[model samples]
Structure formats: structure tokens, C-alpha cells
Target: MSSASFSEQSSDDPALDRIGPALSRLRRRTPASSKDLSRNLVLNVIADAPGETTVGGLAAEMGVAQPVASRTVAACIAEGLLRRTASQSDGRRTVLELTEHGETERSRFAAEQRRAFEEITATWSSEEQIQFACLLDRYGADATAWSRRQAASRD
Candidate 1:
């Protein structure tokens, strides 16, 4: 409501500053601490298909390097969220799937996130909510595009 409070960044604003750090700290877990969750999501994608999930397929879907995907998948396997069964057709290829634990954890994490989001945004009007969502989405896409251009220029 105050003009003084409104400002712009030379680069796109992530609005992380407005939300404080709890959400951001939780978000950092997304591609790291929630490795099991990510793997489970990938496995869910595979489950919809006719065949087992391959390491490379998971890697591409997660947008991570193959080695990182492999490490996360291995860790998920250890935690019993996934299984590392040897592919029947190919000895060198490992197939992954959500164990009962993986499916349960994935569902629980998803519910927690939903509850957290609802708790945070419950007071906003639907119009305000949609506007905020659009703004944040564009900010993220711009931030990512800026990063890619910066990387390309560096090279």
C-alpha cells in the first residue's frame, strides 16, 4: 500500500526477501535433502509407462547430471524408498521403483507442503493469489533465463 515499499531489482526479484528464510531453507532441500522424494516422483513417472525406470531416464527428468541422479537413486534405495533390482533384460541396467516406504514418504511430504502453502496463503483473496502466483512464476522463469544467458556469455 506504500509507494516507498515498492522497488525493483536490476535483475528479477526472487521475492525470497519478502517471504523470509523459512520457505527458502525448506526449498533448498528440494533438489538435495528431498532426494528420496525426487526419486519417488521420477519413479511415479516411470510407473505410468510400460517399463522399469532407468538411471539415465531419471537423470534427464530431474535435470541433474547422471552421476548425481545415480547417487540420489542409490541413497533412496538404501532408505527403502526404492529398490535396485537388476533389469531382467539387461544385467548392466538397474531398474528403480517406489517401495511401500517411498510411496508413503512421497505422499506425506506432498501433504506437508500443501498444508504449509495453505497455511501461508489462506488469507489472500483468489485474485490476489492468482496475481502473486503469476508474478512469482515469471520471476522464476526470468531468473533461470538470466542465469543461462550469463553462463553462455561466460563461455
Candidate 2:
């Protein structure tokens, strides 16, 4: 269906169909730096984990191989963004923690992202921007849940 049809239609499927193209355009327009993006993701995942996070756990969360996660962790360590210390609950195991520098970098990244969002939605009303933010957050959470379910089914 064309964009014109979208305005007249109220069907869920057609509305959902717009997601792919919209995301594609966004990706094309704002090409991300994969290395920086990966670092940011690693910081966020480790920060959000409920318990002490390990390299293996980080790999699972990132959907990457253990070696890949290890390499990333090593890089983060080298950059003073992450530190590996003995897990308090498990004397033999190591857990990842964000260094003070990591926290600073993560906060900086978030601020930059929010600034970009504000700029992109400058023309939008306050209510519309807030509603979109809520929906986008919900979508991200749901997507993560769905991904976990799919991975479980495969296993």
C-alpha cells in the first residue's frame, strides 16, 4: 500500500508494514559507527543486568560469540571503560563492572542520543514526542522479549 493509503486505513498490518522502510531510511541517513555502537551497547547491557555480569553472559545478551564478547571486553578494559574483578558471590568467577570512566562515557552517549532525538522531533508537539518515546521504549522491550523467546525455542 502507498503512503496515501496509510492515512485512510486503520489496519494494524499496514501500519506495521511501514516499520521496515522507516528503519531502513533511518539507517541509511544516520549511518552509525559500529565500534562505538558496540561499546555503547556493551556498557548499557552490563549496567542493566540485574546481577554481576560475566563475559559469557554478555555474549548471550549481545547475541555474539563468547570470543567476540571477550575481545570487546578486552578493548573496553584497555580503554578504561570496564573492569573485571572477582565476583563477590563466586570467588572463582569474574564479573564485569563499569569503571567511573565508563559511566561517564555512557552518560555522555545517552545525552548525545537524546539531543539527536530532540533535534529530529523539533517540530513535534511535546505530547507527541513523549508518546513516541514511550511507544519506542515499549517496542524495544517487546522486541527483546520476542528475541529471547525465539532463542529459547531454538535451543
Candidate 3:
């Protein structure tokens, strides 16, 4: 993986030092599904969206180009994991919906991820695990907010 350099100077925080390496490892690890990470992510993004998901919305959520998202969506559709339909609110607009197969696959991937987390933290106490999970969820939320802020500033 490439170096994650925020600046010429390094941070004094020990956790910050380990974070880049940990994230790199997580990206390299594959899920228990036959689908690649991108496809799995498509299912996840669509399923988790607050409202109907369009191709443009998927691209934004994934932080990818529209064409890249479209291709991935096409692949998922061809595989019977997703379906495209006209938006109920707007006849001309299209939305993405996960098929039953996609839901099943998504559930499988999530279960595998949880299993891996359990295995890795097996030595930790149950309380410690719960605490870590809560902190991690908070971190993810904060990261997403930070990312969106950065993007908006760029725009």
C-alpha cells in the first residue's frame, strides 16, 4: 500500500501511528462473500440509504466517479443482486434496489465481518469488546462527517 502522509511531520499520538497500518490491513482483507468489496459495498450503500438510491447517489456515497459506480451497478444487476426501477416520486429518475439475493449476500458478509471481529478480540472481556465497538462506531460516524466536510470545502 502507498504511504498515508497527511504532512511532512508525524503525530505524537500512538493510536494515530497505528491507524494507517490497521486501515491498510482491513482494506486488504476480503469478506466471506464471492462478491468483491466494491459489489458488496454497492449492496450495503443501497440498503443503508435513508431514501431511494440513484446511480448518482451511489457514486457520491462511495466517493467514486459516476461511470465507475454505473459499471459496478451494472455488474450487480447482471448478477441478479440488484434491480433498477423508475423512482416512485419521479418517473424519469431511476433508483437502485437490492434483490433478495443481494440482501442474503449482504447479511452473509456482515455475519462474517462480525465473526472475524469476535475472533480477533476473543481475548478481550465482553465489556471491553462492547466499549471498543461503541468507540469504533463513533469513529466511523465522525470520519464520514469529516469526509463530507472536506468534500464540501473542495467544491
Candidate 4:
């Protein structure tokens, strides 16, 4: 058989097996930052949230414990990165919103990420970079939906 045909018959699982090691290598090669990753994740989630965000909502969205989400929110508030505002519809309910400083920080973070991405993919063609990004985004969304469905089924 031709090499191309032989390769086509190879087990698909081998390609899947490389994902974990590839991610680990990427993590190791990436430079460390002063900012905590979990905190950054929380900030991004809040900034992207569809509506008013609560600690409970954050916990659910992050798949973290309530106390963990509460503590992160508290730290963000203390750092002036976030604020608690009374909900207009409910007087007693407080929602978490990004402070002006938080907005600036988020923008900075996004820019930095974009720069890093560009640097890492500098050798790749622009079309290849865009294709990779689009595929990665679709994979993430599909994986999240699948996870939620699996969790719901378990419940």
C-alpha cells in the first residue's frame, strides 16, 4: 500500500492522544504572569456575562464552589476591579459589575493575549492562524455544551 493510504488507516486515537501533551508543553513554554489564572478567568467571565452577575451565577458558570467564587469576587472588589451595585429590579439584590479600572485591565489583558497569539503564530500564514482560532473556538463551545448535557443527564 502507498504511504498515504497506510497513514490514513492509522488509528485516530493517536492524534487524540497528543492533545494533553501538547497543552502541557504549551503551558510550560508560556511565560509566567503575576496575575492569577483563576482570577483572570473570573474577570473574563464577568465581562462576558449576558446579564447581571451574582456569586451563585459565577459559581455555576465557572463550575467552581460558591465559596471559591465568592472569595474571588471579594478579592476583585477589594482591588477596585469590580463593584457591587443594587439591582434596579430588586432593591435587595446586588449584582457584580466591572469598575472602570476593571474595564481598562480587561482591555489590557485582551490586547496582551492578542499580541501573544500573534507572536506565537508569527510563522503561520494569516489564513492558517484564523482557521486555527475559528476551529478552537468552535471546539470550546461544542465541548462546553456537551459537558453541560452530560451533567444534566447525570442529575
Angstrom error at residue 136, model 4? 1.8
For all candidates in order, the CA lDDT equals: 0.68, 0.88, 0.86, 0.79
lDDT per residue as tens, model 2, 68-152? 9999999999999999999999899999999999999899878877887899999999999999999988987887788778878
Task: Show the colliding residue pairs in model 4.
Answer: none
State every prediction's TM-score relative to the real structure: 0.52, 0.80, 0.81, 0.75
Q: Write the per-residue lDDT of candidate 3 for residues 91-128, one digit (tens) a residue.
A: 89999999999999888888888898899899999999
RMSD of 3: 6.1
lDDT of 2: 0.88
Backbone clashes in model 2, listed as residue pairs: none
Residue-by-residue lDDT tens digits, candidate 4, 1-155: 99888777874658778988986675454334635555566788888776788888789878899998998899888989899999877879988899988888777766767788899999999999999889877976776678768878887
Q: How much is 23 displaced in model 1, in angstroms? A: 12
Q: Which wins on TM-score, candidate 1 or candidate 4?
A: 4
- For model 4, what is the C-alpha lDDT against the true structure? 0.79
On the 0 to 100 scale, the lDDT of residue 94 in model 4 is: 88
Please, what are the lDDT tens digits per residue for candidate 1 over residues 7-78? 443225775456658546656644334554566556555554346778876775556899988888777777
